[model samples]
Target: MRKPENESRTKTIKAMYTQIVNELRARILSGELTQGSRIATEYEIAQQYHVSRGTVRQALGELTREGLLERVQGSGTFVRSSVHTHEAETSLPAQKNIGVILSHATDELNMRLLRGIEQAARSRGYQVIFAYSEENDQLLARDIASLQMTTAGLILFPLSNRSIDSTIVRLKQVGFPVVLVDRYLADMDNDYVVSDNVGGGYRATEHLAILGHTRIGFAYSRAGDLRTTSVRDRWEGYRKALYEYQRPFDDSLILADLPTDAEPDTDLFDALIRRPDLPSAIFAVNDWVALEFIKAATRTGVRIPEDVAIVGFDDLSYDEHLSVPLTSIAQQGIAMGMHAATLLINRIEKHVLGEPKHIVLPTQLIVRQSCGARLQVLRAPDEKPS
Candidate 1:
C-alpha cells in the first residue's frame, strides 16, 4: 500500500530520530560517554548525523526522560551523575562479569592498566565493567554496592583521601572475591598488587647522590599525606637511601605543600626562592609534580640540572619530550593490572586456596637529561655528541 508523501516523510523522520536515540544510548552503555560528561549540542549532533534540529532535540529529550541525560539552561546536556536508577530498571545478562573500580579512568597510567585488565578478562571469557570513583570514598562505596549485585568478582583501586576499611571489611565478611590494586589497607586481609614504591624512591635519590648531589630535596603534592601507603613508602625509601649514602637529613629540604588542583600556585615557588640555600637536586613524588616544579623553577630563572637537578617517580610517556627530559622511576602499571586481574579471577574460580596473595612488583630507574647524568656522559672526553 502506497502512503501519501507527508505520511511517508513523517515515518522516515521518526525512524531517524529513533536510530539516533539508540546510538546515543549504546554509547552510554559502552562507557564511551561517561557519567557527568558533557554531550554535544543539538546543532552539533544534527550536523554530524545529517538530521534536522527538531529530530536531534526529540532524540535528546527522550534520553533525558529515560534518566540517561540532563540538560541545563544556557549550558549543554550532560550524562546523569548517577546510574543506579537506570541500572535498576534495566535487565542485565546472566553472563559472568568482573567489575573494576578505580580512583580515575582518563589518565594514561589508568588507561594502560585498563588495557591489561581487559586483555586478561577477554581471554578468560569474562565481561569487564568499569566504575570511576574520582578518589571519593563515598562514591567508591556506592559503586561497590551497585556492582556487587551483578558482577562475579571485583577489583579496586582504593581511595587515598579516605579509608574504605569498613566497606572492604564488609565485602570480606560477605565472602566477595576481591583484589586490591595500586594501594592497600594495612589491617585488611585482601589479595593485592602494588609497585615497589620504596625501592623506586631510594633509587631516584641514590642516583642524585651518586651524581655528587649533596643537598637533595624531596617534593610532594598536598593531595597525599605521610600516612598514605604509597607516599609513606616512598618517603621511607628516600630516608633509607640518605642513611646509606651518609648524607645528613635536613627538614628544610622537604617541599611537601604543593597545591593538588589544576591551577598553579605561585606561592609554593616563592617558598623555594626564599630558601637561604637551595638544594642541588629535587626528587618529586611523581612525574606530573616534577613537571610542575620545572615550570615554577623556570619562571624564577632557575635552570634545571645546572642550578638544581631534578628526578621524579613514574616514567610517563611525555617525560622524554619535556624541555629537560625527566629522570624517573618506571612503574609497570600494565603488569600490575594484569596480575591483579589474574589474582581476582583465580579467587572467583577457586583456583587459588588458603591465604590471600600480595604481590609487589619491582621498579627500575630511567635516566634522562634532567638528572645531570647525561651532562656528565656528554662531557667525557671519549664520548661523542650523539
Candidate 2:
C-alpha cells in the first residue's frame, strides 16, 4: 500500500512550499496554464499538494507579486496575460523552423515521427532542425536549448534518467513553444503526445492470459525503469491484467535490470533454462527486449510457443521477419509526431493560448506466432518447457 500524501509532506514546509512555487511557475511560463487562465482554487491547491489552505494562499501571494498571476475577486486567480506577452516577446518575428530531438535516428521511431512531423511542418512551410541523443550525454539539454535559439519551437523526446534542466525551466518560464513526444515530466505541465502504454500493456498481458498461460513473466532492461513513466505505466497494465485474469502477481516471474549484453551468465538467460516452473509466457518491455529474450530462450533449447510464449511492445518493422514472428503492441509514433509538431507550431504562431494539451494515441496488438495464439502450446503451470 502507498503512503498517504500528508505523510510525505511532513518533510519540510520550505521544501514543499518552494516546490509548489516552482511547479506552478513552470506551468505558467510554459503556456500550460496560459495567459488569463484561471488556476485551481486554494482549497483545490491545498488538496493537491496536501498542504494547508494558508500555505496555498502564501504561494499564490508570492506568484501574484512576481506578476505571473493575479487575483480576480469574484473569479479566483488567473495567470497574467501581460506577463506572458512580456516574457515571451522576442524582438524578431516567429521563425519558420521547428527543432526535433530524438533518442535514436536509425530506427523506425525516427522514420515514423519524422515522416509525421515533416508532413505537418511542410503544410505550414516550416523547416525542421534535427538532433539525436543516443549517448545520453550532458550536452543534450544544451543542444536542445541551442536548437531553440535557431528555431521558433521544439519537439523533444527526453532521456528518461535525466532530470529536468535549468535551461528547460528558463525556456518554459519565457513561454517558449515546445511539445514533448513519447513521454513527459510528471511534475511539470508541458504539452505532450504519447502512446497509451498502460492500455497496450494490459492488452498484451490479457492476450497471453486468453491463450491459457497462467504463469507469465515481464522483462525490463533496468532497475530504474519504474521511475520512467512508459515502463511504469506498462507494468501497471500488466498488474491490472493479472488481476482481471485472476492470475497471481509473482515477483519471481519478473526479470529486471537484465544485462544489456548477449553473453552467458545473464540472469534472464540462465533463469529460463535452469529455473523450475518458469513462466510459460513472457511480456517484454519493448520489441528489442522481446527479441533479446527470444534469442536467450531459444539458445537454451526452449521451443517458441510449443514450450514458452512471448509478447512484446512496439510492433517494430522487422518483427515479422524473425524466425518466430513477434506478437507485439503497436504505438502510433507518426501520429504522435504530427500531433506534437502541429501543437508546437500552433503555439509558436499564437494560434493556441489555452491550457497545455496532453494527447494519448491508442495502441494496437499485432498478433503473430510468438505469443502462442495460433500454436496453442500452453503447458501446465508446473511443467517445464521441453
Candidate 3:
C-alpha cells in the first residue's frame, strides 16, 4: 500500500522547515546574527529559500521555543540575549579535563603560555584540551560552546578586537568557571591575569629618553576601537614617561592605523616614512611590529640608531637574533599562563569565590642594540672624563 500524496508532501514541508531552523541556529551561534540583532522577515526568508511562509514561521517558532530567538509584537525575530536564559547546569566530569582557548596557539608568546599551562595542569593531575579561535568570533563561540559541554573550566586568551565581551559576560552570568589570560574586558567583573603593560610602555620610552632620544614615536597596529587594553595601557605609560622626563608629548608622534594580519595597509607605512617631522626613535607595541617597521625603514635607507631607534614590547626570544637586537619589555608569558590556569582550577574547586580577582604581573625592561643604548655605553667609555 503506497502512502498518500498529501502525507508525502507534508513530510517534505516539515523537512524544509527543519532545514531553515538549523541554518538560522548556526548563524546565531556563530555570531553572524548577533544577540538582539533582527533576523530576516518570514517573507524574506521564504523568498530567499524558495519555501512557503508557513515553513519560515515554523522554523522561527522552533528557535523561539529553544530560547535562541525572540519575537516582539511589533518587531521582527531577534537573536535572544543569553542573559535571560536559565542557569546552565554544571556538567564537569570527574576526569578533571580543562579547556584552553587562544587567539593563536602557534604564536611564540601563546606557545610559552601554553607550555606553562600544560606544566601546571599536569602537575595538578588535570588534563588540558586546547582550541585555537584564530581571532574569529564565530570559531571562538563554537569552541566555547564545545568546552562548556565537556571541560571542568576554561582559560581564555581573548582577541584584541573585543568582540567576545558579550559571550564572556554570558558565560559569567551562567556561573561558568573561566579565567581570562593576557587581555580583559573593561568594567566586567572577571578573573584575569595580565602583564603590567603601562609599566612596560613606560620602561621602553624611558630607555629611549635615557639614550638621549627625546623625540620618540609610538607605533601600533590597531586603529580606533580595535585597540587592546595592553596597547592603551602602554600608551598611558608612554605619556607618563614623557611627563617625568619633562618632554612635550606630541600627539603627532603617535602612529596607529597600521596593517593588520588580515588587511595590508601599506599607506600607513608610507605615511610614516614620508612624515615631515619624524621622531628620532619609535616604541612599537610589540616585537613583530617593531621588526616590520625596522625592515621597512632599513629598505628606505633609514639608518637605525643614527636616524632612528626602535624599542618593542614582548621581548620575544628571537628579538636578539634580529639584524639589530631589539630593546623590549619582557612579559612573563609562561608565568602568566601558569597563574591563569591555577586561578581557574581554584575556582573550579570552590577554593575562591565572591569578587573576581585581577592579577597584574610586573614587566622588565631589556636594553639592546636597536635603542642605541649600547652605543651610549660605548661612547661613555671613550669619553675622557667630561
Candidate 4:
C-alpha cells in the first residue's frame, strides 16, 4: 500500500530540518551571523523551512549547546558571545603570533589596552590571540596553561583576589616569556609592566587638597583587602597625600565594595553622598566608578565640581563626552602594551636570554571640567617646577 500524505509529510519535515540546521551552523561558523545579531526564531524558521516547530526547536537546541546561539529568557534567542572565536585562533602560530590574556574583554579599560596591543602587534608583523577569564583563579590558571602551549609569548592580566605566586614562579622556572599587565604577584621575579598607581592616587588627592578642599572621599571596590598591587598602592598614596596636606585621615569617608561587577550601584553611591558631612571631592579607582559617582550625584541634585568634585583613573573614551567632563590620571595603555609586547617578543627571539626584566611606566594627570580645578571655572594655581 502507498503511504498516506501525512506520513510522507513527516519524513519531509525531518529532512528539511536537517538541512536548515546545517545551513545555519555554517553561517554562524563562517562569521555570517555576526555578534549580537538575532537568529531566526522557531516560528519564523519553521515557516521558512517548511518544518514543524518541534523540528526547529531541536535544531536550535543543538547549536545552543555548541555555544553558537543563546536563548534569552524573555528577549528571544541571540548569537552567543564571540569569545569562542578568539579561542579558535589561539592555535594558529608561534613566532608571528602573541597571546593576550585579559580578565574581561567587555570591560572598557581592558578593551582600550587590547586596542593598543593590537596596534603595536599588527605594525610589527605579529598576530594577536586573545583569551579572557572571568577573574576566576582556576580559569585564569587554565588560560595561562593554554597560552604556554600555543603562543610564542604571553601577556597576562592576573586574577586579583586569590594567590597565584606559585603559578608565576612555575612559569618563570620553566623560562617562559611573560609580561604581566595591571596586576602583579608580591615579590615575584616575573617581568611586569604597570602604571604608577601610587603616584596617580597621591596626585589625585593632592590636587584636591591644593584647591582648598578638605574631607575628600576615596572610592573603590574591595578597598581594604588589598588583593592586588594596584589597590594597595592607591590606598597608600591616598594616605601619603593626606599626610602631606596635614589633613587627618578619616576612616568614615572611605567607601569600599561599591559594586564593580558589571554595573555600579546607585543606592550605595546615594547613601555615601547623602551623609551630612559629605566629601567635597571624590577620587575613584577607575572611570566606570567615576561615571557612577557622576550619575548618582546628579540624581541627588548635586552639582559637579561645585558640591562634590570627581576625578578618576584610566582616562576612558566617554570621559570627555560627559556634560561635565571628568578629570583623570591618564595611563598610557597603548604605550604600555606596546612596550610589554616588544619585551616579550624580544625574549622570544633571543632564546638564550637568561633572566626576565621588569618595567614601570609613568602616568599623567589630565585636568578636566569635573575636578572644579578647570582653568576657566577657578583661578589659576601656581604650578610647581618639575
Q: Give the top-scoring candidate (lDDT).
A: 1
* Model 1 C-alpha lDDT per residue in residues 236-274, reported as the tens digit of each score: 889899899987788887888678567868777755744
lDDT, candidate 3, 73-98, per-residue tens: 89888887651111222233634878
Q: CA lDDT of 3 in candidate 3?
A: 64
What tens-digit string does per-residue lDDT give for candidate 4 at 1-386?
A: 56777766655666666567667765654456776688877999989877788999988997786556889988888876542335455445677778888876556556556666766777777777777776766877777787677778788887776445666678877877788987677767677778888999999989888877778888888522466787778878888999999866887778777885655567888777777777778888888778888888888988887778888998875677676789999888877788778777878888437665777778899999898876424455563211
Better of 1 and 3 by TM-score: 1
lDDT of 3 at 79: 83
Poorest stretch of ten by lDDT in candidate 4: 377-386
Top model number, TM-score: 1
Native-vs-model 4 lDDT?
Answer: 0.75
lDDT of 2: 0.77
RMSD (CA, angstroms), candidate 3:
18.2
> How many pairs of residues in model 1 come into backbone collision?
0
lDDT tens string, model 2, 1-386? 45655644543555567667767865664456878889999999999988899888999998897677999989899998654321243233349878777776455565578668867987887866666666365656766767777789988886774445455666799888878888777667888899999999999999998888888888887623776778888999999999999998878889787655335345557566446777888899888788876777677777787777899998876677676889999999889888988999899888988899999999999999998776664545565432
Score each candidate by Cα lDDT: 0.79, 0.77, 0.77, 0.75
TM-score of each: 0.75, 0.70, 0.72, 0.72
lDDT of 1: 0.79
